[model samples]
Target: MKPSTSSFNEVKKAIVLLSGGLDSATVLAIATAQGYECHTMSFDYGQRHRSELDAAVRIAEQFHAKTHRVMQMNMNAIGGSALTDMDIAVPTGGLSETVPITYVPARNTVFLSYALALAEVVGALDIFIGVNAVDYSGYPDCRPEYIAAFETMANLATQAALEGHKVKIQTPLIHLSKAEIIQQGVALGVDYAKTVSCYQANSEGLACGQCDSCLLRKQGFREAGLDDPTPYAI
Candidate 1:
């Protein structure tokens, strides 16, 4: 769903793909702090970890986003990952070198398509996505090469490009490790407590404390020398 652009102004506008996770929340805070009128988008893509949606709203509000939009998508129907398919149990094991089951098929592609459409609607030239390669979950879509390819495709696919207004896909967190991301967010006064990273958080938004996401988040906080503020369902 597209949000009202009533708050959009002369300041530069940026479309942020916010997943309500720690990285995305930090990206939103970073974009807003950089003086962009942030238009945040979150997806209700039929994932088992739907609790993150609520956290997205909270983070958006906290950063004073120009608009916060939640788009309902039926990725469950095309599920290939454990996140959208209930039959495939979420892995509690540690991260692996290969692509994990939690990597939703073409999720970032679909997400970026929506963001591109919204950017055209609101005249935004910049789109920010929180896809990190370092300390990532081994998702193919999280790589910097993938983001660059998508950006190139977006520029060619949109009418805005014909008019000489190129769309830039900005992955500010792409190279940063989780610890570095947390440090950046801390410097920007981001409230990490409101973010959720568990692959299967409960309805109350408590982390399972076992999934890959939760483990990564825990490690990040520990490495950053900060307390983990997430509530766990353990």
Candidate 2:
């Protein structure tokens, strides 16, 4: 027997910002399991880590996203942050004051600008991003207020929103600790091996295990009592 037409029509579609990191991968799985036709979008923003992008591609393929678009937004022009700057060093130790060097200036702004464009083209009202405040890197854009402000901006900026179709920026992993995020993702059957969170992975994707990203990821997995799935020499 054929599936019901209503059933097919009822699938909620989402545009997910997948970065091939643990948080984003888990977000995609959650969206898929929740019945969203997830369309993933990643960017080659000239960051030090291409491994994360590669991992994103694998994660997108794992879910078989309706479509995956990797956009190239050049932020190499602005060398304000560590990820983009050769001079600055990625900080160690627990989360620090106001912001970290890894905090690219308006990184989320650049990313969300693209996500919004794609969402408009695809007519998807929901956008899933894996930005968290609990295990955050102190970027101002990672906060809930920032997201809310962006949502409001989206409502005003988009023609569809003006015409009554509103969009939602869903950060499911927001406000959750790294360990808690890991636990949730695992419970949701997210195979995190496909995700990469190292700030200093080599060309061959070997994680440095000392960068802030790697350290946090290690702590999270350890706290969760789960072995690290990333293929890194740590």
Candidate 3:
């Protein structure tokens, strides 16, 4: 039941995973520019920082995304990852050999599942996710192979693909490094200040400069030679 992978026709409608992060926001911009009528999906997955949801909403509005769904996936009820568990300490240092404690458990899988459902309901043929492998070495879901596999699975599982139309999973930021992604966003006129990337941001929306998210942001801006306007308390 495998559908053709190569030569996928460009889809007109797309659903983007807008997490209020820099990468997703940039991806949304790319999708909009491509003339896809964008629909955005965000989750309240019990992460430490819910402020990102606000950012997600604002980003979706800027793009005039046709629909923005904020589903509640209670990953907190499982209680394994650092994002869901309060006891584990957030990592401070830069890149590591293995995945970091902040890696959420099968987060992309769950998010994509919801996106698939929503896309089918709306007859959207493309899904956009911002998963960067080169820049984010710690997350398993950000790997290229994993995303490719997911694309294959989507083709097989979906009725739309079986019926002849192609379903695409777009990862515009996958091949790009954080610096390159930032550069692309800058060129696209993305308002970086609206995105949030802090694992431990305060209620006042101040980033903890020590967390892995903050460290990566620091490195990305440094590499791109761009200043991040998002507030950081450090």
Question: Could you estimate the TM-score for every candidate?
Answer: 0.95, 0.92, 0.92
| Rank by lDDT (best first) | 1, 3, 2
| lDDT for each residue of candidate 2 in 83-130, tens digit (9 for 90 to 100) | 887677776665667677888888888888788877766677899999
Total clashes in model 1, counting residue pairs 3 or more apart in sequence or in different chains: 0
Better lDDT candidate (1, 3): 1
What overall lDDT, based on C-alpha atoms, would model 1 receive against the true structure?
Answer: 0.90
Candidate No. with top TM-score? 1
lDDT of 2 at 155: 86
Candidate 2: Cα lDDT at 208:
76
RMSD of each: 2.8, 4.3, 3.9
Residue pairs clashing in model 3 are: none
- Per-residue lDDT over 82-161 for candidate 1, one digit per residue giving the tens place of the 0 to 100 score: 99999999998788778999999999999999999999888788999999989989999989899989999998997677
Q: Which residue pairs in model 2 clash with each other? A: 20-56
Worst 10 residues of 1 by lDDT: 1-10
